[model samples]
Target: MPVVPPPVFALAAGIAQHLLAPDRPAGGARKLASAGIAVAALGLDASAVAAFRRHHTTVNPLDPARASSMVTGGAYRLTRNPMYVGMAGLLTAHAVRRGGWLTPLPAAAFVVLVDRLQIPAEEAAMEANFGEAYARYRARVSRWLPVRA
Candidate 1:
């Protein structure tokens, strides 16, 4: 079975909010901030992908079996789920751009769904494939945020 890429799902949810919301708060600064957030989120995504590529692993989120190597540098050093983090960031930016009290709902839902559904499965697969190395990595890194222990 093909799983939906987390980023795509997140982006879709963000876009849905943009489509369903009736109004955007009137402000140039808000839009600029949103744009800045979106750009930064995308940069994080790209960096994650680049790191994966450098590690000679599959960047395709749907095919865990295709992953050829473990990645533990760059964005991976910060968060085990940088791709998901970036996706959430994109969704957050959309929420900011939409500028409604309810705008965050979809992004929150995306994070919940991805965290509960997607990440565990990936972690399991990595543990199965990479064994102790993955365990060490998991022990060292936060699943979402990068905080020093």
Candidate 2:
């Protein structure tokens, strides 16, 4: 289990971004893009949660081993870790809204930390629980985003 939930880290990083550059002026384009990204991120989270509920699996990230079944539908088809990706997207949206060179640093750090620490542990537990099925899913889906080229 991860010592800290990914959301906590994301939340802290978001707060840090504002503290670093609270008054950074965002233009209309930035605000629009931020809103779009935030909406997409929220939708991803909702879809992932619904998929887990449909599969009768646990949504608890700290206990992947307790997952009753694998969730391959909805947002899971695009990314193995939609919730984490959503969190990252939200941070990115906040960074864009904040609009400073340094604002994105915290979001970048959140991605690195989640990718390196939280996700690997979850993947291991998932592999242990689902075996070849999860291996196939892992192979089919990207961890955070789908490949375009």
Best by TM-score: 2
- The digit string of per-residue lDDT tens for model 2 on 71-91 reads 888788888989988998999
- TM-score, cand. 2 vs. native: 0.94
lDDT of each: 0.85, 0.89
RMSD of each: 1.7, 1.4
Tens digit per residue, CA lDDT, model 1, 80-129: 98988889888888888778777788888998888888888788888889
Off by over 4 Å in 1: none
